[model samples]
Target: MSLRAARDDDMAWLRRHYHQRRAAEFAPLGWPAAALDAFLDQQFALQHQHYTRYYADAQFLIVERDAAPIGRLYLLRRAPEHLLVDIGLDANQRGQGLGAALIAAAQDDAAASGRGLRLHVEHGNDAARRLYQRLGFEHEENLPTHAAMRWRAREPVATD
Candidate 1:
């Protein structure tokens, strides 16, 4: 697996991925499939605009395997901290070790820089929350829609 800068061609795939993940959350509501699709499209557009406006400097990356796009990772590097804006994998790519590896890499980067790594996970996303927790991230704040989490750099143990 590798990451590359997202290109214009990747927007469609990204939007589709966003819709698939979000639609599942809304599935229980029993909205008509067509109506749900339209709603998700609008929401995705709003979210894309929000992220672009607020995180213009963040690295918007496309995660690839064997030259095929499989996911995305958005990261913002800031002094004393790094923000994991978003990470998602295609349905077929889920349940693999890729997400863990990516998070581990981010943790290593944070440790090397003496910085904390942070992210927000939707309150309903138990899987992601559990993963973050297992990887040492602790909930820092509870937002109306999501929970903010952070992982602090570990202190080095002195070998006497």
Candidate 2:
């Protein structure tokens, strides 16, 4: 129910989480177990390097509940907009409104900063797309593999 800066020790969990989150996607390929592990390792390493190099200033956070890690949220604060680089909850943690609550908190933070929040969801992830849309994110662009979405803070209503 809270976010904390990722520690060096968290890297192992992060890597395992990444693999668990992605293993299902490659399952349909019928790759051998060793091949799948190798592929996932390469992909994880590349993604880690890319995020580190490009989002050095971003908040690499571990989402925890009762002092145990349950997910990760990578957010980059920028003028005009804040980038939600990535968010992933443990498979067992999905649903039950946790993801929505976490995203709502991020939205609140973005609104307080007078900025919009943006993220890219894979086209194949219909559930995530629906969740983002329900959270008020609008389609900004369609990339080859992912959809770019943005959520702007609603202006306050005026009273007479």
Candidate 3:
């Protein structure tokens, strides 16, 4: 798998994958299909340009595989540090190490930039929570949905 800057060519795959992924998450929340669709439409409209802004700010990227968009890794620069806004895989790609690879890529970016990385994950998402913990992230605060976490850059070293 490889990561590339998003292009118009990647939109179709992104939309389908994103909707599928979002639907699964909202499903457990008891959201109706219409509500989920509206949320996704709004989210897409609001976020489609994020990579451009982040890239300008030097913060985000889209992860691709075989030329198809597979996931996203975004960082929000907040003065003292940056928060990882999101990192996720297409539904079909989960369990294939893409999620972990995405997080690792984010961590690699943060460490390379000499800044700490932070994120939030649901308390009940044991798999994700454990992955973050394994990568040396620790709790910083509690969010309504989960826990705010941070991983301070230890030393400048490459990890693959």
Candidate 4:
């Protein structure tokens, strides 16, 4: 898999991906399908504006495999800590090791820079939470809607 800078043309796909991933989350709230779509449309626009305004310098990347877009990864490279703002895969592309590989690469980058990698996962996202834990991330704090996690660079062991 490879990453390319997200372009204006990608906005539609990003919106669709966001909608698909979040639909199930809102399904439990008992909203009708049409109502859910309307709600998501407004929410997504607000979220996109917020991210662009606040994280203008963050790298907005589209994850691609074989020249086809498969996901998105937004990362903010900062001193002492690298924030993984968001990472999502197409529903069909998930559970195939792509996310893991991307995260592992981020971990390697963080270690090389002596920085910690941090992210927030939705509280109900058990699969993602498990993946983070299995990759050595520790729960840092619980937010209103999400759990903050951190993975620090491991200290080198002295060889005998």
RMSD of each: 1.3, 1.0, 4.7, 1.4
Ranking by TM-score: 2, 1, 4, 3
Provide TM-scores for the models.
Answer: 0.94, 0.96, 0.73, 0.94
Any idea what lDDT model 4 has?
0.92
Please write out the lDDT profile of model 4 over residues 1-160, one tens digit for every residue: 8999999999988989899889988899998888999999898899889889988988999999899888999988888799998999999999999899899988898888889899999998999999999999999999999999999999889899
Q: What lDDT would each prediction earn against the true structure?
A: 0.91, 0.94, 0.75, 0.92
Model 2 C-alpha lDDT per residue in residues 1-160, reported as the tens digit of each score: 8899999999889989999999999999999999999999999999999998999999999999999999999999898899999999999999989999988998999999989899999998999999999999999999999999999998878999
Better of 2 and 4 by lDDT: 2
Clashes (candidate 2): 0
Cand. 3 TM to true fold: 0.73
Question: Which candidate tops TM-score?
Answer: 2
Among these predicted structures, which one has the highest lDDT?
2
Clashing residue pairs in candidate 1 are: none
lDDT of 2 at 51: 95
In model 4, what lDDT does residue 158 have?
89
In candidate 3, stretches whose alpha carbon ends up further than 4 angstroms from where it belongs are: 8-12, 28-36, 43-58, 76-79, 155-160
Predicted structure 2: lDDT: 0.94
